[model samples]
Target chain A: MIEVFFQYDFLRYSLFTGVLIGILAPLTGVFIVVRRLSLLADALSHITLTGIAFSLLLGRYINFFAVLNPVYMGMIFAATGSLLIERLRHTYRFYRELAIPIILSSGIGIGVVFISLADGFTTDLFSYLFGSIAAISSTDFTVVLVLTTVVVAIFGLFYKELFFLSFDEEQAVISGIPRRSLHFLFILITAVVIGISMQIVGILLVSALMTLPVAAAMRLAASFKQMFFYSVVIGEVSVLAGIFAAFHLDVAPGGMIVVVNVLILLIVLAATSEKILNRKGG
Target chain B: MKNSAAPYVLEVKNVSFSYGKQMVLEDINMQVREGSFLGLVGPNGSGKSTFMKLLLGLLKADKGNIELFGSPVQSFRDWSRIGFVSQKANSFNSGFPATVFEVVAMGLYGKIGLFRFLKKEHKKKIKEAIAQVGMEQYMHKNIGRLSGGQQQRVFIARALVSEPELLILDEPTVGVDADSVRNFYDMLKELNDKKNITLILVTHDIGAMSEYVTDVACLNKCLHFHGDKNDFEVNREEMMTAMYGHKVNVIEHNHSHDHHDHSHDHDDLDGVRS
Candidate 1:
């Protein structure tokens, strides 16, 4: 792997982006899982797909868009989708989850229209849908790196506030944690995470990379910090293993990564099943 | 109520709030003095929790003004001076993966502000808050692993960690056992008496409210009665009548009547009230 990275810049970019996405995805996923907003990630991922599809369509005709990175457009759409989700959730307060499906459907609707208008399927669209090792560029690596840094920095700044909000939103509000702004920031960050991660993990499987490790971690972790650490570790391992497997097995890295995460989840469930069952029985 | 040179910790003047077309709170007037334990009692859907939310600025009042520590609620940025334990604190996210200490430390987050970190003094305050709630033994314990009452205490500790001058709790002991409920009130009393912390407790347990609180406020979408506990006792029937919008028998139960097998006692109380 070291020799391959040294020999091929594409491999280096691919692996680098993979590892960072691994860390950032599950770190934010801890909050998503805890908040029961895992569906929001799925919605945001679909929105990113729509953005990619639209950018692709524009690139086919427009000189400026042809040179621009599609990920930037993906991020803008994802962020807009996040704000819309927040708005819809607030508007339909009782049916908060309603935002997810509405956004997801709209994303697919727009994406399908854009793909059709662009005169059909392309290799780039396929890579964005399922992620390809050969598709990652140095620019994609930089974007992922910057996004990961932002996520880490946000957490560092608002760790306690986020924890309180996630743990007990009522208390967080009463404690005056600026619930509205903080929550908005959180969803925006979630959008950005999905946008950056979709290059390696792909739009369809990106939510899995965000959620699966945290889901596995939640079963055994004793505290919030422990859950976060375990999720990051699990994510890192899954990403590395998936990348290696994809290299050897000649498969899409996104699908391979998600498969690795599912395997890890199953193993964790198997190992902790007895204790969980006993707990329930007792 | 102990005068104790205590100023008004909270003041609500003609406050009214509504959700959509439904009037949740109507023309409410209340003032909580410093070093006072006030029990706010009402039936389900009586807006007890909504009233707390208004005071805590969680819900904006449709009309009227609220002041915390002499500052208008809209301008009251010093949240550390006011602690709130919401009604759903017990039932919210029971499986939340946080330790007792971590949960308590969250109380200081607003005061600690953004971009800064918890200091040594903040850690000490967190520990002290946990110890105050008698949850020191479970400082490192996962909040989800604790019993309902234990989790409630952790929430109280979280509120206390901020060292607020006034603490507001909305139904803090909903599912707690008799013993734990008793202990919970005793802890609140201790905080009020020893620390001069003004307390506004919203509870359905009128019996506990009458016993532990220095003052009583009867509410039902409106302020029916607000006075000392003795005065509330003197006008008990009238207060209950105003609260239920019908005549109700006031049961004469002893202070120590709360027990684990409270079903029978509750039946009798219900029989009298109904």
Candidate 2:
């Protein structure tokens, strides 16, 4: 099993891609969960699916589309969807969460239409939806690598500002934090993360990979920094274990990774609950 | 450029604000002198929050000029010099996974500027601010697990971390208990007196605040009364009746005799209907 990784380029590519996504997803996930925008990740992932499906559909007729990676289209569609969500949130104002459902439904609706136009779900679509170990190519690895570098750099530069904005938006705005541009950049980055992560985790389960580790970490960690640290640790563990198990079991890595995350969350919840009960008893 | 020698820290001249056709504040003129603790008291929907927003540059005044530190608010960029703790500070999501230390550290983000990490001096400042708020023991505790009063104190610590020249608090004692409210006010008074940080506290509890505030400004779509606390105390009944459009009772708690016992003066003006 260990020799298989060195022998097979696909296995090595998928493993490296998983490692990068594991770091990026949870890093951004901390902010998303804290801001109570967990559902926004799910909506954006669905929107990325629209891009993926559109690319697949276009490949049938357009020679250029056949060579182009669907993940790029997914990223483009996801970015557009994120901007629309921001615009709609302002439009509704009072019903801000309305933006999530509207975008979510439109994404899935448009995605289904595109999938149908592409003559229904093929094996390639299946791999993209559930994630396959063999499907990750060198090109996919390069995309993830570049995106990881850009996202990490942005997070590093604006870490404090982002933390302040997430905690209290009104106060951040009052303190001259450029709330509009920061928020715009935040959601745009979130969209790109969701789009790129779909290669290993699939669009359906991408949000889970982003959110579950944060949820589990929040239960155990005392501070935002601790939660961030713990979330990345949990994300890395789940992705590595899930990928390894998937290769051995010949199953979808996305499902295995989400299951591992769920297991970790349950364990953390149980442990924390017992601690709380003991504190009350003593 | 900060006019450190300027007599007034804030000046609002003929400021009028409206939301669409409805007027919230009308031609409000007020000045907060340097080193004075001004308590802005008003009934609900009396535009106290809106006034604070205008001062913080969150909202633009429709009809007048507002200045902070001798500079027009439109061009005044020294935000770190003015710290603000909003009314919603206590009402924040308790489930947020940040410690008291992490929460207080965020107050320096603006001052620290972009792309900069917290240095040793910044960390020392954060700890000192937490100590100043008397939250050192709970420095590592999750902010959500703390009591409303403790959380409010942490927010005040956050505001103080930047060492601002002016600190503005809006209804900071809304959900705080009677005892904690007294301590909160005492802390604000200490900040004003000892640190000489000019304070602007917007609250409904003008009765409790009268002990600490150097000046009082009663508002009801307009500045009904703005004067020294002594004048406010002398004409408390008449001024409150005129501002609230009804008879009101002003309970002045004597701090010298029973500083600890605040059960009688627990509620704000709304609680004291008579």
For model 2, state the Cα shift of residue B219 in Å: 0.7
Scored by DockQ, the top model is 2
| C-alpha RMSD of each candidate structure in angstroms | 5.8, 5.8
lDDT of 2 at A51: 95
lDDT against true structure, model 1 = 0.83
Give residue A220's error in model 2 in angstroms.
Answer: 0.5
- Taking the candidates one at a time, how many backbone clashes does each contain? 0, 0
Tens digits of lDDT, candidate 2, A55-112: 9899999999998888889999999999999889878776889999999999999999
lDDT of each: 0.83, 0.86
Model 2 C-alpha lDDT per residue in residues B1-274, reported as the tens digit of each score: 1124548889999999886797889999998888889888887778887787788876779999999999998888999999999877766787788899999998999899887899999999999999999999999998988888999999999999999999999888877778998998999989988898999998777778888898899988999888688888899999888988888554653222222212222111111011
Q: For residues A181-202, write the lDDT of model 1, one tens digit per residue.
A: 8888998899888887888878
Cα TM-score per model: 0.92, 0.93
